[model samples]
Target: MDTDRAAAVDPIDVEVGFLTPALRSDLLERWNEPQRRYHNETHLRAVLRAVDALEADGEAFDATEVRLAAWLHAAVFDPTESENNERSAVFCERVLDPSAPVEEVARLVRLMGGHRVEVGDLNGAVLSDADLAVLGSDPETYDTYAADVRHEFAHVPGERFVAGRIVALEGLLERKSVYLTRAGRDMWEKQAHANLNRELGLLRAGAAG
Candidate 1:
C-alpha cells in the first residue's frame, strides 16, 4: 500500500513549509475528505515531492508560488463535479496570505484544470509537471493510482467509468509530450507514455470482453 495515506497524516500537517498553519489545516481538511481516493493527501504529497525533485533537477521557477499552488490546486476536489479546479482556485484566493503572490498562485491552481500550461509560463509549467508526475510512476505504483482513481468515482457505473477514463487517457496519449519541464520530460515522459498506453490497452480489452 502507498505509505502516504491521509489517515497517517495529522489534520494540522505542516509539511508544505510555506502555508500558514490555519490555511494548511483547512487545506488538509479538504484534501482528506472521506470521498477522496486518488486526490487525497497522498496525491498532494506526491505533487510537492515532484516539485522539489524538478527544482533539484534544474527546472527554474518561483518555488513559493508553485508550491503554494500545489497545496491548494485540488483543495476543493469532488469526484462528481467538473469545476473543482475553478472552485479550488476560488478557495485559494479566499484564504491565501496577502504577502504571497495571490493572483499567480490562483492562476497556477486554475491551470491544473487542463494541465495545459502555455509556453513562457514557467510557474505553470512547473506546477503542471509536478501535478502530473504520477503518470511516470513505475508500473506497480501506476496501477495503484489507477485503482484509486477508479475508487474515487465509485459512484459512477462501471461502463460510464470505463468510457470516461478512456477519453481522459486518450487525451493524454494524444499530447505530444506529457511533461512540460525538461527534467520532467527526461524523467517521466517515456514512462508516462508507456503507462498510459498499457492502461488504455487494458481498458480496451475489458470493454471488448
Candidate 2:
C-alpha cells in the first residue's frame, strides 16, 4: 500500500521561503473549513510538491503565483455554492495587496473548477494537473479520496449527490487531457480515465436503482 501510494506523489517539493509566516498561517487557517476537507493543507502541499517536480525539468513559469494559486484555489469553494471559485478568488485578492496583479491570481483560482483549464497556460496546466493527480493514484488512495469528497457533500440528498458527481466526472472526461505534464500524462492518464469511467458507471447504476 505504501509503495502504491508513494508512486502517486509528485517527486519534488517547492521551497516556499518567500511565503511569510503570517501569510502561511492565514492560508492554513482559511482552508480548515469542513467543506474544504479534501482540498486542505495536505492537498496544497501535494500540489506544490508536484509543481516542484514539474519545475525540475526547467520549465519557465511563475513559482510564486503557482504556489499562491494552489494555496487559494479551493479556499472559496462551498460545494453548494455556484460562484464559490469566484468568491474564493475575490477573497484571495483581498488577503493580498490591492496593488497585486489580481488577474493572474483570479484566473488561476477560477481554473480550479474543472479540467478545461488544464490547457490554459504553462502554469495553469501544471497547477491543474497537480490538483487532479489524486484521481490517477492507486486504488487505495483513490478510494480514500473519493470518500473524502463524498463526505464533504454528505448533506446533499442521495440523488443530488449522484447527479452532481456525475456532472463533475463527465467534465473531466470531456477534457483533452487530465494531466498536462508529459510525464504525468503518460503515467496517470489511463488511470484517470479508468477512475472516471468507474465513477460514472456507479452514478449510472445508482440512478437506475
Please state every model's RMSD to the true fold in angstroms.
Answer: 4.5, 4.3
lDDT of 1 by residue, 134-202 (tens): 999999999999999999889899998999899999999888888888999999999999999999999
lDDT of each: 0.87, 0.74
Instruction: Report the lDDT tens digits of candidate 2 across residue range 41-157.
Output: 677777776666566554557877887778778776677777877888888777776565567877888888754553438878878777888888887778788888887777788
In model 2, what lDDT does residue 18 have?
Answer: 41
What TM-score would each prediction reach against the true structure? 0.91, 0.82
Clashes by residue pair, model 1: none
Give the C-alpha lDDT of model 2. Answer: 0.74
